[model samples]
Each structure stands twice: as structure tokens, then as C-alpha cells.
Target chain A: MIRIENLSKSFTLHNQSGVVIPVMAGAHLAVQPGECVALTGQSGSGKSTLMRMIYGNYLAAGGSIMVGDVDVAKASPREIIRLRRETLGYVSQFLRVVPRVPTRTVVAEPLLALGIPSDQAHARAEHLLEQLNIPQRLWSLSPTTFSGGEQQRVNIARGFAHDYPALLLDEPTASLDAKNREVVLSLIEAAKARGAAIVGIFHDEAARDRVCDRTVDVTGFTPQRAA
Target chain B: MTQDQPLLSVRDLAKMYGGRIGCTDVSFDLWPGEVLGIVGESGSGKSTLLGCLSGQLAADRGQILYRGRDTRQMSEPERRLLSRTEWAFVHQNPRDGLRMGVSAGGNVGERLMAVGARHYGDIRETATDWLGRVEISAERIDDRPRQFSGGMQQRLQIARNLVTSPKLVFMDEPTGGLDVSVQARLLDLLRGLVRDMGLSVIIVTHDLAVARLLADRLMVMKDGHVIEHGLTDQVLDDPQAAYTQLLVSSVLQV
Candidate 1:
């Protein structure tokens, strides 16, 4: 299970003459295991920021984010690494991998980080990459050279490589074609079947309908100052 | 040679340092735009195999054919020209790949100059463009590599090696010395560039994560011998070799 309570985060822009920008304030949400929650909001409504906060990429100014028993907001860097390794998974809009690395390795990385053996990790990554329909020929090339759709598939594969307890997905299917989108939807179903808690941002209503069990409107939790 | 022939081929290649073996009976074929990874623990001879294949170290026996020509038969100047114009090597350390005293733009521009690129303005413009492509700001073009962070230096080194648009690249642990976040970002940038340019690459690393992510095919080496070779997925998912299985399981236990 994952829970966020009175979560507030703001960024001070030093480049903009030290002006403070409130991203999220007093936002509260809970995602139970086996449930998928979609974050809905307009552009700049802090949907991505909220996701990053949950992933411990952004520090919250106040409040709490609890994933399983660890409070993400208060967790140390080491604790966060362990949580990411064993429990939390994230699929960002863009795929990040070492230069000159092949797709199979990129997909298998998260598992390897969790101390999964190379062969097993490779097997899982290969399955996910195949599921996403990334061509075997392109698997040896760098994702940097991949098309937007292909890169997203690699990103999705990395995220789903492990059976994480909690997952955060940012537009997992944004660049995907219909066939690939269907694959992602099925993967999400499988994750939920295993009782993983999920929070995602889905601009496509059809995709949202397919996987999201509920919706949370970010605008409702917008910081008062920003509002 | 047929049009479908491999871009590079190695057969029964062997190397030795005095009485000690470096690598023996290695063989493989690399298609254009394909990425092949060689993996093993330290002293496993993966590095020696890479050195022999890249022509940095001479092989004691067997053959290496590049674009249908035997590399051993090529003149010294011819080999130098090939290294400068058609091939690139990315070292594990950024310092090895980059010239710290020179400006970033100069580092990239020099590669172009080596390949007979003239027109000073054109060189500078291309350097700046490559910097941007590698996710480095153009504003840092004049800064020396010493002034850059480790991640930035690695990115700059990539931009330098890639500015000439070499058809083949060899990388040795390109991400071995960086924070996790920085490594991820660098990998992303590298992937995009290789894909965009349709480069053929050979990479050496002990880190299976890197092999899994980048190599199309993989060769597993142990004690100067090739233990396993197959599609990256096959070698990793269902390794047939006992050594490879142990390597896979040991990484997991770590």
C-alpha cells in the first residue's frame, strides 16, 4: 500500500530571481494494493511533481509519503535506494540508459540492481521487451537511437522488469502505437493481479479507463498561492 | 565479397603475453549497425579480446577482416587512417578519451580536423552542434574538460568521438565511474546518439546490466576462452554454459 498525506512541495527558482513556485500543497491520496490510481489535471497542475515526490526524486516541503512501512519523505538516501531496489518502480516518460548499451540490458537493469541473477534478469527483460514488440535487431542498439515509441517500450520494460510492490508511471503509453498500448494495458493488469499499488498519469482516456481503478484530480489539491 | 557479408569478422583469433594466454580461438561476425558486448570478470580476457579486435593489440594467430580486407595485411598508415576515419574507441576513463587541456569544442573539432575537415567556422559549428546533441550546452563549448563534472566530461568525450560520425565504435565500461543518476542520464544520451546515427559498436564490460541494455549479441569469456556466445537475450536468459550460469547466479547473489 502507498499513502500520501498533506503532501506539499514547492521549488524556488534561483534563475527567476529567487521566486518560489508552489507545485503541490495539502494533497492527500491513498492507493491500496491491487488498485491503480490515475492522476488527472491540466498542464502544470503538478501531476508529474506529485509522482516524483512519491518516488523520492523531489523533496516535499511538508507532509508525508508512505510506501509500505517506510515514510518516503523522511527516508534516508540508503533507505530510499533499498526501497527502490525491492519495492518501488517508476516508468518516466523518457527512457534513461547508459550510452552504447543494448535494449536487452537496459530492460534487465532494475532486476540486476535488486540482486537478481543476470540470466534470470535477462530472461525477464527479454520477455518484457518482446511483449512490447521491440524488434530483436534493435535490442542490440542504444535506446538513444530508438524512436519515441520504441524508447517508451524500453522504459516500460525496465519499470515492469521486477514485480515491485508499488509503481509510479508517467504517461507509460504516451508515445506507443495502439498495439503497444494494448501490451502496456495487459502488463498493468498483471501487475495489479499481483497486488501492486500503482499511481499513473494517463492523458488518453481510453488507456486511463482500461487500467485506472480510480482518479485523483490534482487541481483540487493545488497550492492556495498557485490557485 | 557479397553485399550481405558481415561488416567485421574474426576467426580463431588468439593472443598471448609471453607464455601466458590473453585470449584464444575467439570467433564472431558483426553486422553493420549491430552492437556486440563482451563480458567477464577481471582477468577474464574480455579486455584482451577487445584490444585484439580493435587493433590496439596484435593477435598471435588467426584473422580479422574489416569490410573484406584483412587488417593484418594493411599498412601502418592504412590502419591509422582506418582508426581515425572509420573507427572510434571510448575509454573507461573520460580522461583517456578526452584531452583535458583543450576546450571541449577543440576536442570535438580536432577529430574532424584529423579527418581532413577544414573551414574553421564549419568545425566550430559542428562541434557546438554535437555538444548540444550529447545534452551538453553550447555555452560550455570553450570550457576545458577539467572544468566539467565527471558526467559532463563523459558526455563531452562521447561528443568528441561521435563528431566524425564513425561507422563503428568500441566502448570500455563507459559508465563505470559515475553516480547512478548520472550514469542513467549518460546511457540515455548514448542510446539516442547510437540509434540516430545507426552505429555498429563493440563494448566490453563485466557489468551484465550494461551488456543487457546495449549489446545485440554477447560473448562471455573466462580465463582467455570464449565460454558462451549467442543473442543477448539467449545468453542471458538461458545460458547454456556452466560458467555463464554461475556468472549469472553470482551477479544475482551480489
Candidate 2:
């Protein structure tokens, strides 16, 4: 289970002479295991910010994010690393692969981090990449040269590679083609069936309708900046 | 053991010091999170084999593939980056692994710095955290490794190597030169950290007990060749090769 309460995050832009911008304020949500919650919002409504906070990528100004027994907001770096390894999995809008590393390795890394045998990790990565329709020829090449749709597939493969307790997906199917989007939708269904609690931003309404059991509007939680 | 692409693949890897064979025709695949223990008498090419695998010593023949790329073909800078970030080598002597001149915190912080962690506070916090993880006292963070006891120095060395959260670590006699009690404690600490981090490790040890404690799989070497290899329990229990049988029975008699 995942819980978020009174989540507020503000970024003080130094370039704008220390102008403090509030992204999210007083947001509250709870998601049960096996539930898929879609975060719906217009551009700049703090959906991504909320998700990042849940994943502990961004420090919340004030709030609590509970994933299972661990409070992500207050967890130590070691605790966060453990959560990432065994409990929580995240897929952001962009795929960050090490330069010159092969696509197969990028996908296999998470499983390797969990101490899964390399053979098993690579095999699982291959299976996921195959399901995502990544070409066999591209497996050994770096995804840095790949198209946006192709890279999104790689990101999805890496994200779904682990069977985590909680998963955060930020625009998972955004740049993907219809075929790839359907594949992602099915993957989400499988994850849900496996009892994974998922929080996602699905711009594709059909994708949201297919995977999300409930919707949380970020617009309601976001505060408009003062002039 | 499993039919999956290896994280590290070595084919007919050989290194020689003049006419003497350091290691010959050493071919194997290391799987992720799997600890491959290379055990043999001193000069049986255990250190030589590790040197070749770690890119510290160049191979005289054959290919070493890391993540499916030939490591021998990789540029020096690329190999250095891999060593500094993805791979770690823990030397038999703590002095070889740690900088005696630097503070314990700085030793651990150096690896983070190499990887581009510019925030001093974050680096110091991480260094302190790792020091604690490796059973070093928080108070000794400012003390140099030269000022520490042998066991503490070794623990600090391990902390330094692991601070980067490397996927693979190569340990050469990590428990060597320590008192029996200290060795036992260090082994326990190492076992816990290894399990928690899910790190893939290749450990070279002459101590059979060390192999039994740390290794998932055993690779027995003799005269610069791998005489036998199997799961730790199976090899230690059944003893397939004659040399391995001798090795196992010798430990039992002690």
C-alpha cells in the first residue's frame, strides 16, 4: 500500500532571484495494493512533481509518502536504495542510460541491483524488450541513438523489469506508438493482477481508462503562483 | 550454469610472466549477483587471473567481454571509468586499497568524487554512512587509515571500495593478515553488506573456509588452470575432481 498526505513541494528558482514557486500543496491520496491510480492534470499542474516526491527523487517541503512500511520522505539514502531495489520501482518521462552502454544492459541493471543472476537478468531483459517490440539488432546498441518511441519502450522495459511492491510511472506511454501503447497497457494490467500498487500519469485517455482504477486530479492540489 | 548472456565473459584468457604461465585458457562467465570464488595455493594464478579480469593486467591472449563488449578493445579511459564507477578492487593489503595519507572519510569520499559528486556535505554524509555500514566507528572518520588497527584499516578499505555502490567488486584475500576473531567478525559484516546490496563479487582466497562462507559457486584452480567448478555446497560436499576432493578433505581434517 502507498499513502501520501499533505504533500507540498516548492522550488526556489535561483535564476529568478530566489523566487519560490509552489508546485503542489496540501495534496492527499491513498492507494491500496493492486490499485492503479492515474494522476491527471494540465501542463505545469505538478503531477510529475508529486510522482517524483513519491519516488523520493524530489524532497517534499512538507508531507509524508508512505510506501509499505517505509516513509519515503524521511528514509535514509540506504533505506531509499533498499526501497528502490526491492520495494518501489519508477519509470520517468525520459530514459537515462549510461553513454555507450547497450540497451540490454540498461534494462538488466535493476534486476542485477537486486542480486538476480546476470544470466537471468539478461534473459528477463531480452523477454521484456521482445514483448516491447525492440528490434534484436538494437539490443546491443545504445538507446541514446534511438527514436523517442523506441527509447520509451526501453524505459518501459526497464521499469517493468522488477516486480516491485509500488511503481511510479510518469507518462509511460506518451511517445509510444499505438502498438507499443497497447503493450504497455497490457503490462500494467499484468502488474495490477500481480498486486502491484501503481501511480501513473497517463495522457492517453484510453490508456488511463484501461489501467487506472481511480483518478487523482493534480489540478485540485496545485496552487497558482502569485505575481 | 544457466543459459543466459553472462555479465562478464572470458574466452581462452591467458597471461604470462615471461615463459611461466600466470593463467592459461581461463574461460568462464560471471553472472550478476553471483559470487565466483577462485581458490588455489599461492602462485596457482589466482591473483593473475583476477588481475586480467579487472583490467589491471593485460591478457596475452583471447578476449574478456564485459556486458558483451570486448574489454581488451575498450579505450584506457573507458576501462578506467568502469573500474572507478562500476567495478571495485579490494587488495589483499589494506595499504594498497586505502590511501594512508587521507582521512578515512576522504578515502571513501574520493570514489564519490571520481564519479562527480561535487557536494561536500553529501559526500561526507555518504562516507560516514558507508563507514558505519562497514563497522567503522563514526568518530574515526577524520583519522587516517595509517592510524587505525589492521582490522579497522581493512574495514575502512572495504568501505571505500563499496561507497560508490558498484555492481561488481573484486576482493583479493579480504580477510588475510587479520586475527582469527577479527576475520570472523569482518566476514559476518561483509556477508550482511553483500546480501543487502545484491553486489556481484569475485573473491580470490586461499582459505577454504572463506570460500565456504562467501561463495555461491566454487572454481578450483591448480597449476594455472581451473580443475573443477560447481555450486559451493555440491563441490564442498561431493568433491568431483581429485584435487577438489583433496582440498575438501584437507579442510575437514583441520
Candidate 3:
């Protein structure tokens, strides 16, 4: 389960006369096990900010963001890294490729981190890549030079390779073809069925309706409106 | 030791040389099977940090806890025993770590002997196996390191250090003196060995590409200060510090 209470954030511009920009305020949300909540908002409404705060990517100004019992906002970097390795998974839109690392290794890295045998991990990664429609020939090659769609597929494969208890997916279906989109939707459905608590940003209305259990409009948490 | 505790825990570690800062207030935990790369320019004190951690140089301040035991607090002989058994260091120059006058087999077998392998045949077989693993042939085992190429000597040095299966390895610019192709081959061999053996490594390198290839986490040093430390890919790709950004950007494309 994931929980957030009294969450707020602000950005300070150190340069240009030291301006402070309050982004979100008094945000509260809770997600149960096996539930998928989609964040809905226009640009700049703090949807990504909220997700990043939950994942401990953005340090929250105030509030507790809990994935299970540990508060991500208060956790040390070591705790956060451990939490990411074991309990939580994030699938961003982009694949940050380390040049010369094979695509199979990249996709299998999550499972490998969990101490699964490399051969078994690679097998699961290959399965996910196949399901995501990446070519077999590309498995041995690195994903750095791949096309946008190919890289996205590789990212998805890496994300779903491990059965993480909680997940934050940023545009999981973005830049996918129709067939791949269908595959991604089914992956989300499968994750939900397997009791994963998910927070996702889906711009596609149909996909949101199909996979997300409910929608939380981040517009309600904007700092100016809250003030 | 607790199951979740870090393999190596360093707190407020610092070393200085006559009012000149070597590395100051460097703190981090190296988890089991993790590779932590210390990267900076020529005088950044990355090598200084390595020397202090590997027990080759004594630190002026702070504590280094290896598996719940403070290394600095240990007696000299105990620390030496730990160094010979559970710890290994690979130098940038192979001559620094390898006994150039000794045969390649003898260089590796000496580590086994240090760890109490009295049987000659067994030590020789293990030395030969390790030599082959590092891609040096059996025939070269009897030859002195002076007869080997730079890369072969480096490989022989790796065989010497790893023959004991040290729990933690300290490598300072392990590929610094090698050509590009040789460096690539050595990196590949190291990667495979690291994964297969689950070795915990503290590697200090000026090469970002080397850090990118080998390290799980990275600490970017500047003027003896740790300016940035994070996951290697995160630090490299989305570098927050201006110094780290410059360091990453300055890598040549060719």
C-alpha cells in the first residue's frame, strides 16, 4: 500500500534574485494494495511532482509519502535506494541507457539486483521484450541507438521484469504503437491482478479508463488554488 | 552482522597531508556486491581516498567499519591478516602489485600461500586456473612478469589478487595504463568476474567511461571534497552539480 498526507512542494531559484515558487500544498492521497490510481491534470498541475515525491526523486517540502511502512520523504538516500531495489519500481518515459550495456542486461538488471540468477533473470527479460515486440536481433545490442519506440519498449520490459509490490509509471503507454499499447494495458492489468499498488500518469483517456481503477485530479492540490 | 547492514560503512572519513586536504568528510555505505567508483580529475584526491580505505595509507580522521568492525581500531597484525585474506588491492601499475622477479605462477601462488595453502600441486593448479581465467596461458605461468606485455602483466596481477577471493577489492585506475582495446578486454573480464563472484569493489578512476562501465554508485570528487554522489547512471545522465556536469560533458566522443 502507498499513502501520502499533507504533501507539499516548492522550488527555490537560487539565482535571479532568490525567488521561491510554491508548487503544491496540502495534498493527501492513499492507495490500497492491488489498486491503480491515475493522476489526471493539465501541464504544470503537479502530477509528475506528486509522483516524484512519492518515489523520493523530489525531496518533499513537508509531508510523509509512505510506500508500505517507510516514509519515502523522510528516508535517507540509502533507505530510498534499498526501497527502490526491493519494494518499489518506477517506469519513466525515457530509458537512460548506459552505452555498451546489452539490451538483455539492461532489461534484466532489476531482477539481477534482487539476487535472481542471471540466466533466469535474462529469460524473464527476454520474455517481456518478446511480449513488448522488440526484435530478437536487438537483444545482444545496446538500446542507446534504438528508435524512440524501441527504447520505450525496452524501458517497459525492464520495469515489468520484476514483480515489484508498488510501482510508479510515468506515461507507460506513451509513444507506443496501437498493438504495443494494447500489450502495455494488459501488463498493467496483470500487475493490478497480482496485487501491485500503482500510481500512473496516462494522457490517453481510453487507456486510463481501461487500466486505472480511479482518477485523482492533481488540480485540486495546486498551491495557488489551495491558498 | 545484520543481514541488511552495508558491507563497508564509512563515517566522516578524512585524510590530509600537511595542511593540504586529501579527502575530507567522505561518507558512504558500500553494500554487498556493490561497486562504488570515486571519480575526479588528476589532483581530486580520489586515489588518496582509495589508499586510505585499502589500508595502504592511514587516515587522519574518521572511522571505516568493515562488516561491523572498525578497521582502524584493529591491531597492526590483525589488519595485515585482513588485508592478506579478505581484502585485495589492484594498482594502476602492475609492477606495484606484482612481484616482477617472481614467475607469474609464483606471484599468484604466493597469495594462496599467504592464505595457508601448503600443498604445492593444489596451489599450482589453482594458480594456473586463475591465470587462464585472466586469459594468460599456462605456458606463460613459468615466465617472469617482465617477459609479458603490459596487458598480460596487468592480468597476471589481477590473478594474483583474486586468487584469494578477497571479499572487498580496491582498484585504483585498474585500466589507466592500458591501450583502448586492452582496457576494453580487461573491463569485460572484470565485469564478468564481478558479477559471477559478487565482489564488492571500491574503484578510483579519472575515466568517466570506466566508472560508467564498472560502478553501481559513484562519488564525484573535486578538490578533495565529494561534490556529488549518487547512482552511477543518475549522476552521469542527470548530473546536478556544475562540476559533475562539466566532467560528464567533457568526455570526448571519439
Best by DockQ: 3
The predicted structure with the larger DockQ, 1 or 3, is: 3
Q: Of the candidates shown, which would achieve the greatest lDDT relative to the real structure? A: 3
Writing each residue's lDDT as its tens digit, candidate 2 over B1-254 gives 33255678889999999999899988887776678899988988999999999999999999998888999999999999999998999998999998999999999999999999999999999999999987788999999999999999999989989888898899999999998778877876776577677678899999988887778677899989998776664466545466776676667543
Error of 3 at B251 (Å): 7.5
Clashing pairs in 3: none
- The 0-to-1 C-alpha lDDT of every candidate, in the order given, reads 0.86, 0.85, 0.89
State the lDDT of candidate 3 residue by residue for A1-227, as single tens digits.
99999998886543435456789999989999899999999998999888878877777889889899899878866677778989999999878655667899999988987789989999999999999999999999989889999999999999999999999999998899999999999999999999999999999989999988899999999877433
TM-scores of chain A in all candidate models: 0.97, 0.95, 0.98
- Give TM per candidate: 0.57, 0.53, 0.83
Clash count list over all predictions: 19, 1, 0
> What value does the lDDT take at residue A51 in candidate 3?
83
Fnat, model by model in order, equals: 0.16, 0.00, 0.03
What DockQ, between 0 and 1, does each candidate earn?
0.07, 0.01, 0.15
Q: List the RMSD of every prediction in angstroms.
A: 19.2, 23.8, 3.9
DockQ of predicted candidate 2: 0.01
lDDT of candidate 2 over A93-156, digit per residue (tens): 7775434568997898788767788899999999999999999999998898899999989999
Residue A221, candidate 1: alpha-carbon lDDT: 84
The stretch of ten residues in a row with the least summed lDDT in candidate 3 chain A is: A11-20
Model 1: per-residue Cα lDDT over A20-135, one tens digit each: 77777789999999999999989989898888878776667899999999998887544565688799999999765566677898888787665578799899988888888988
Model 3 DockQ class:
incorrect
Residue A151 miss distance in model 1 (angstroms):
14
